[model samples]
Target chain A: MKGFIDLHLRPNLEERVEIERIIKRAAELGYRAVGVSLPQEKLQERAREIRKICSDLDIDFISRIDLEPRNSLELLRSLRFLRRRVEVIAVKCLSKSVARQAAKDRRVDILSFSPIDLRRRFFDSAEAELASKTQVSLEFDMAPLLYLHGNQRINLLWKMRIETIIARKFDVPIVLSSGVSEAWLLRKPEDYASLGYLFGLDLENAKKAISENPKKIVERNRRKLSPNYVAPGIYVIRRGKDCPK
Target chain B: MPKIVRRRYIAVRIDSDQTIERKDFIRAVWSSILRLFGEYGASQTELKMIDYDPTKGLAVLRCSHKALPMIKASIPCITHIGASPVTIHVERVSGTLKALRRKLSI
Candidate 1:
């Protein structure tokens, strides 16, 4: 499985070299794909530039677009170019109304709800709004707000257990991300396993939460996924056809 | 000629008390002693112990050179091989090819 970082492209700072370097480093480290974190304002020009970069490097580029009206317009416009070149469009929906609109306007490879606030009152509503859609999926941010409440430190095991239970209940497809702000912070799969174990994550479910489900996003979008691919229950690159249940 | 790398060590620390059955005691500490020896380096330390038995309630650890520091740092509780209260010292030696290869490189 592969993972990526969001380049919070700051203005007036030359991002071309830095972005290229980051991509180069990622490729060297054996990442399967990369995603750009685009603010609503700069989607048009930057998407063009990123498309070019991805072409030159032969790496898959995914555009993570915010689901605000202003950003949606830019994303919708870029969808023409993106239809052929880009791998996936990650839409972070603030509201179900915007999500439905984006779904209707352009094909979103992945739909994620990254609400900064922790009320969770809106999740059922958001889930209901997109309940009918197929091919598009959801991701959990594991954000501090979601895991930790005021004056409380959340147990990682309990959180994983709960999320797995909830995901099963809703039959919703989910992906796990570190929500990392830096590049050097990439963690090993074993580390995630230990954490999952600490949080009551069964070995198979923990593997799926980090490795299988996230890879599904790329496999769903791309035409040429790697041959040595591992998926849910299937542990490739090893002797085992399936992880021991 | 390849330079010899420090591979393993053995520590047999003698402790007071000599009342309980020695063989069963050594069997019980076997797993813990091995685990502590393996975690000597970031990867596989690849250490091994030949034998630990009862002699005046003494504890003994046989491990690899790279694993020496870790073996040194660990509490004697793991290497304590006898039934009675005893201090154990670790003696280490160069491991076989399989062990060294497992420890070498990233």
Candidate 2:
């Protein structure tokens, strides 16, 4: 039942006060993790201030890459102070090229395919190839799914394809997130379980995607995720083992 | 596979060239059409029937037009004038709240 909320960090406009408010609220709400999106204009000092706030709270801090492809190295370099303070580096990959380039950086904790960018080009064949080459885990954001609901059948079809790719590929781990913006917009874990089941992720895998996997990401990156490493119990159901697909 | 309580249909003629396109088009229209047929189907407590084809440039859809407005509106454009079957399939899904209440009352 543990869930994470993306704080949608706005770098300017007195973010420390805003972030502290969210961190305290998140701690109260029993949220195990909080993700922050970096703005392109972020300076080294700004990253340090954010990192310090997260460290002080003993909350799991996840940094989502905010800069474009050309600025990725700079983004990585700027995030050095926050790296030891943050657990996961969430990158947006719009194309196979972007995904490949993002994959080159071992610092990236998760590679999420952007639906906005991948709408025209379905990730049917290319994504599988990329996953095979990278050995990096993939994540599907829920934002595009909502946006493309009535507009594109390809969007729905692509999600199905991506989930199928994750299952059959075996080498890559696929994580699912609602990519929530407003706290009230968070979907119940049961809701995701149904969608995952429909998309060929069995109950066990669905549970992992919802609960355990994020915890693992956070635990693995302890200094950034939190002051203490609290590894939760995980029940692994090997694909095609004990359950019929 | 479940016990079918209501039946309606959309019959479309399938031509070789545009079979897939016609099928996709009809299916895209099918969901909207069902909304128009909702009331009649609701009163009758029955399921729906759906069928369509592209080869003959015809679509036959069946559902209660009273309950669904969209279905009634979209049917005419794809309707076949000379086609013998003007039926639309209505499917009353099992375990619906209405069905559950009926069973509970009995």
Indicate the TM-score of model 1: 0.47
lDDT of 1 by residue, B1-106 (tens): 9986655534343434554355555454444434433333424445444444455443334555654444443333332344333333332223544453344311
Candidate 2's TM-score reads 0.50
Estimate the overall C-alpha local distance difference test score of candidate 1.
0.46
Per-model DockQ: 0.02, 0.03
Query: What is the interface root-mean-square deviation of candidate 1?
Result: 16.2
Worst 10 residues of 2 chain A by lDDT: A4-13
User: What's the true lDDT of residue A79 in model 2?
Assistant: 50
After superposition, which runs of candidate 2 have C-alpha atoms over 4 Å from their true positions?
A1-30, A40-59, A70-86, A119-135, A223-245, B1-106
lDDT on C-alpha atoms for all candidate structures:
0.46, 0.48
Error of 2 at A41 (Å): 4.0
How large is the interface RMSD of candidate 2? 16.1
